[model samples]
Target: MLASLAQRFIALTLLATVGTAVSAQTLSSDQRVLKIERMAHGLDIPWAFDFLPDGSVLITEKDGDLLHLAAGRLTRVKGTSKVLDQGQGGLLDVLIPRNFDRTRRIYLSYSKRLGRGSATAVATGQLARRNTQLEGLRDIFVAAPPADSGRHFGSRLAEGPDGTLYVTLGDRGDRPSAQSLTSHQGSILRLNPDGSVPRDNPFTKQKGAQPEIWSYGHRNPQGLTFAADGQLWSVEHGARGGDEVNLIEKGANYGWPVIAYGRHYSGLKIGEGTTKPGLKQPAHYWDPSMAPSNLLVYSGSMWPDWRGDIFVGSLKFGYIARLSGQPLAEVEQIRGDETGRIRDLREAPDGSIWFLSETNGALYRLSR
Candidate 1:
């Protein structure tokens, strides 16, 4: 399927965006024509963004800025949490809950200073009616056993079908901690809206495990989302070439360090080969590591032919990868001059695709 899609991949670049009239590119792939436009620019390391109920956008800058973009203007949203802003630790994902229209509540995931080191934390706040500030912002959950390392916070948030929040946390560069149930490191946490543990959580009845843990044995899971069918999925950074997209399951263990398809940065083998008896295998993996940032399972409202497909932003390769079909495969790679270091890929409210480019410090939109 991958080879066939590669042979059929066709792209036609049109006029680049200059004044909000022309598009940056008119790309053709997967039998669809996609128009890419630069929606906003001059951002400083915009990591993640989500659309609000009023057609505005809330963007998170890794340097601790919450920007509200509306009417072609960027306004700084005050009263956000103070982040560490060291290494990969800083302001990250922004999530607008499904009930935002009634609650005006928003969620943010960032690297919070904990004791000596920084840990991934999730916070909620009420967006002021004026959209210029956040009111009553408070931390909901923070990962435990913070490490001194400044890498791999893995701060991404997704609201489950049941209104629960799921947060991804990295291993803090500690490989073995992924296998430990006592620590929240390298795990995906599921919590109620108020930061309390769900009564029916997978580990709530377990003796030593953290009650917030939904799944374990992840290295640095940055990309997290749910499909229309309510199934959860995640994409995580692997050692050298084993970047993976896994189907997240409750109480399941995804083998990291113990069994991985990639080798260490030192070119040494990881774990005891790829396959293990009990560990879960990835739905798909990339060799040479694309430094995946976010995952989106497209609904295909604009391009209906591509429904149920997966789109991933590549921070290292500077492109958006489209994965589809059963047993998932990388069907196409969308690249353009505007696609530098793609940081976040999200399906907008109108079914258009919005992505952040760290290399360009811009936000771009894609539609048919």
Candidate 2:
């Protein structure tokens, strides 16, 4: 875990203070000057970001704005689809695939208006040469049976090593729907680059099952990432204190509303206990919910000691959580005023850490 490295970081400058820092046990006696620099500012609800082939960055704001940040300058990208922008729904995630340079294509997940209600949708488009607009935007996949309430729209996107796309969807405040394969609610979907269902998907041939469904029974899974070994991992929000980090597999049942470690908000027990015969247990979990937002498996290019470690952002506690070890437990809490309500965590191409703070409405980079 990076907690031990925290002791070696000596602050070189002080910014406006917003919260107290947590102390960690020293991992090494070698001290290095830690720099927390604000990269971009004046953002509003910036939900997600991804690196472009040209070394710039694309950031999405929950309110339907796509931002381009390069060399300390910010530009608003045009041609984004219209989003609901209510409750938890909005333009959420922006992703650049491995073949970005060749295709000039990018993907987005957002809350789209379906009928009178709203549902999660994924769209793809080409970034203009100027990086000032998105062109030919079109929806490839849209979750079904939209919900009236904007409570749970789990919209996160990740590209697989094999070029497929994985999209996470929430239960839409409908608990029972998680167990229903007829609906896309509370499910992880696997699709080809062109938005077609992969023939090898676990439920593709199953009767009465949604062909796109890869895994189900999840509750508000907002964080998803692939490990260096190609192992897929995800983190989801629980009702009260059951935030979870799960190792995802094909055709697995994650038992939300059927089995859970935490109870309902009203102090009532959830499901038929924590474990069921067909349900998968969380690889790691949090009680007193941290409101986890994004998940990252560090490459350790900058800090070799952190290679393969897990880093997650906590929206509720305003900190970045570091998890490592065989069993995957929290080894450190990296917090400060600049980290307030971290909405996203990304590892830059150069191996530094960049994150968006909702409370501060700015982008920050952590480096030594």
In terms of lDDT, the best-performing candidate is 1
The residue-level lDDT of candidate 2 at 215 comes to: 96
Superposing all C-alpha atoms, what RMSD in Å does each candidate have to the true structure? Answer: 8.4, 8.0
In order, candidate lDDTs are 0.88, 0.87
TM-scores of the models, in the order given = 0.93, 0.91
The positional error of residue 248 in candidate 2, measured at the CA in angstroms, is 0.5
Cα lDDT tens digits, model 2, 89-165, are 99999999999989899999999998889999999999999998899999999888888979789988999999999
Where in model 2 is the C-alpha error above 4 Å? 1-33
| Tens-digit per-residue lDDT, 256-351, candidate 1 | 879998899999999999989999999999998998999999887888878999999999988899999998999899988888998888998799
